[model samples]
Target: SQTIHQWPATLVQPVGSPLSLECTVEGTSNPNLYWYRQAAGRGLQLLFYSVGIGQISSEVPQNLSASRPQDRQFILSSKKLLLSDSGFYLCAWGGDTEAFFGQGTRLTVV
Candidate 1:
């Protein structure tokens, strides 16, 4: 069975701190990967995505970046955090038309 694992169900970070969040999909290879952030009641916003290893695309210009270091793993990172960066981060995997999301990580920046 394919599953996505995202860590640190919740995180608290002071402003200007670095951040790294990882996600991996098991039982699947070369699946399309995505990173999304949801703020309060707003809809999920696509942050980044990958079609293959070493192939990453950013959906928005922000304080975050993503990388596909392996076929089934994706990482989101930031050199410095901003107060506006606080939100729920999610990792997902799927194909052209369907996507499966992991349990998101809620980030709080102070």
Candidate 2:
């Protein structure tokens, strides 16, 4: 079966602290992967995406970076946290027509 694993369902971090979130897909190869952030009561914002190993595309520019270290793994990282960074982060994998999402990570930066 195909599934996506995303970790640390919720987080609270002090401002200026570092952050890392991870997601991995199983039972699929070369799926397009994405990282999205949803602010309170707002639509989702695409942060990063990857189509293959070592190929990443950034949809928005801010305090975050993403990496595809392996075929099935994606990581989102930040050097410093900001209060505005707090949100619901989601990881998803897709083919051309459909996408599946992981249970999101809710982040709060204080």
TM-score for each of the candidates:
0.97, 0.97
Task: Superpose all Cα atoms of candidate 1 onto the true structure and report the RMSD in Å to 1 decimal.
Answer: 0.7
| Predicted model with the maximum lDDT | 2
Tens-place lDDT per residue, model 1, 1-110, is 99999998999999999999999999988899999999995799999999999999998999999999999999999999999999999999998789999999999999
Whole-model lDDT, candidate 2? 0.96
Q: State the weakest 10-residue window (summed lDDT) of model 2.
A: 41-50
Local distance difference test scores for all models: 0.95, 0.96
| Pairs that clash in candidate 1 | none
Q: What stretches of model 1 exceed 4 Å from their correct place? A: none
Error of 2 at 29 (Å): 0.7
Worst 10 residues of 1 by lDDT: 40-49
Q: Over all chains combined, what TM-score does candidate 2 have? A: 0.97
